[model samples]
Target: MLVDSHCHLDFPDFENERDEVVARAGEAGVGLLVTIATRVRKFPVVCAIAERYDNVWCTVGTHPHNAAEESDVTAEELVNLSEHPKVVGIGEAGLDYFYDRAPRDLQARSFRTHIEAARRTGLPLVIHARDADDDVAAILREEAGRGAFPFILHCFSSGPALARTGVELGGYISFSGILTFKKSDALREIAKGIPHDRLLVETDAPYLAPVPFRGKRNEPAYVAHTAAVLAETIGLSPEETAAITSENFFRLFKKVQRPSMRSA
Candidate 1:
């Protein structure tokens, strides 16, 4: 069975087809999906999607791009919101220097807040680090010193240095559809070095769809394509890749109940 560790079903791309999108994921052997939240105030929309799907789960926290807007959302608020049964993680937060949609300082501050919540709840922090590798690694290293917390570098497309830092801290590395792009050989080489138990897969859907589905509207069902390429990059069969990543997903996101894989 497979698990899409990060996606945004609440996004408008899946509006009228949410049911079909999820069904397709199930038919593609994806047993579980964790739709991420990008804004704290709009969490109800994200939460409602999770509540509507038995096999779907969610997180609570703001993305770095919107850090400035949600600058006031406290760590305590994230911890409290994460108490919901369907909320399995703490964030899709971290730095995004490429876009610089929010000020770097605000992004760093917001990242720390989410980290604190992760530490308190024992739920994994679903991180998204882009071109700001140095700051992201520094913050992670600094915060981890206060007390270790579980986290996953979601949609990993950064430098090897950051990947190494995350692994050294015992955090997981989740690959998205970007892994299947033809020009991602360097990224594939990084994936090869990660410990098998620390590897994960996601779609980050309504965005970067994998090859064969590239240029198309992404959905959880396409995570399998990403997994296939990732398996090839890491020298494992697709089925084996699925099992390992699914196990890793459950291991890190302990708040989520592992779904039965009778059909998987």
Candidate 2:
């Protein structure tokens, strides 16, 4: 079984057939799907999807793009909302200089809020970093000093140095379908060196739908393809790859309740 460590099922892209998307993932050997919160104000949409599916879970945090809108959100709100059993992690938060969609200052402030929430709740922080490597790395290094906490650079596309710093700080690195791209040899090189205990996999769907389905809409089911690529990069079998990454996932996102075997 595999877990889609990040997704945005709440987005309208799935509204017409959310049920089928969830079913297709189950049929694809996916046992758990974590629909992440891009906007805290839209959490009801995320929670509703999670509540509807036995194997799906959710998180609460503002994404870098919406960080400006949620600039006033507090760590208390994040921590309190995350008290729900279905809520397992504290973000989709981090820097994204690629678009500068949100004011950099707002993004930094919101990212810190999520970090504080993770520290307060003892849950893993789900980070999304892109093109803001140095700032993201420096900020993580700085905030990490405030307290001991766990976090993951989800759908990681950063370089090996950031990966090294991430794993060095007791964080996990999750690879997405991007690793399967023929042009992403650099990403594969980093994937090849990730320590077993710190590696995880995701789809980040309905976005970056991996190769073989690059032009298509993605869902949790596609995590299998990403895992297969990782297995090859690390010279392991697919099943072994799944087991290893799943174990690392459980270790990092400690708040996720392991569903019973029946649900799995």
Candidate 3:
């Protein structure tokens, strides 16, 4: 079974049909989903969605776009909020120079705070890096120097340097629908070089829907399409791709109880 390791079920895009969206994922063989949080203030909403669906889980942190708004959020707060059984990861937070929605310094500060929470809580940090790979890598390296913490480079679309740095620092690289785009040859080459155990697939849904469904609103169900492309990219069958990514998911998000074999 596939695991959509990143998505936003709490977004208004799925407000009216969240149930149907999740049902479609299960029907499509996506046995698990993690509805990532983009704001700590709205965390209860995100957590509620996870609580409503047995197969769904969540993370807690402010997105880089909202870093200024949640600038005062402390690592202690993130650790406390993450005590919920449904919260399995931390931060969709990192540098987003592409958007520049918040001050870069604020984004960096928030990213480090989330890292601290990850270190304290042992929940994997769900990092969202875009157009700021160098700074992101610097922060990651500096933070790793402080102490090792598990993390996933969520929705990764960065250059090879950051990809190599992430894996070297013991972080998993999660590819999204972008991996299936026709022009992502360089990204595919990067994927091919990644070690099998450190690879993962996600949809980052309500955003980049994989080929054929491109431009359409994405959902957990479409993760299978991305998985199919990843299988081809790495010379594995669709079933093998699903198995390996799912295995990687559980290994990193250790708090999540693996579904029974029968469930798959």
- The lDDT values for all models are 0.94, 0.90, 0.96
Instruction: Write down the worst ten-residue block by lDDT for model 3.
Output: 255-264
After superposition, the stretches of candidate 1 with alpha carbons farther than 4 Å from their true spots are: 261-264
lDDT of 1 by residue, 88-111 (tens): 999989999999999999999999
Q: Candidate 3, overall lDDT?
A: 0.96
What does the lDDT read for residue 239 in candidate 2?
97
Cα-based TM-score, every candidate: 0.98, 0.97, 0.98
What C-alpha root-mean-square deviation, in Å, does candidate 1 show against the real structure? 1.7
Residues 1-264, model 2: lDDT tens digits:
888898889988898998999899889988888999998998888888888888888999999999988898899999999999889999889999999999999899999999999999998999989998898899899999989778999999999989998988889999988999999999999998889889999999999999889979988899999999999999999999999988888887776778774456
Q: What is the TM-score of candidate 3?
A: 0.98
RMSD of 2: 1.3
Task: List the candidates ranked by TM-score, beginning with the highest.
Answer: 3, 1, 2
Superior by lDDT: candidate 1 or candidate 3: 3
Error of 3 at 21 (Å): 0.4
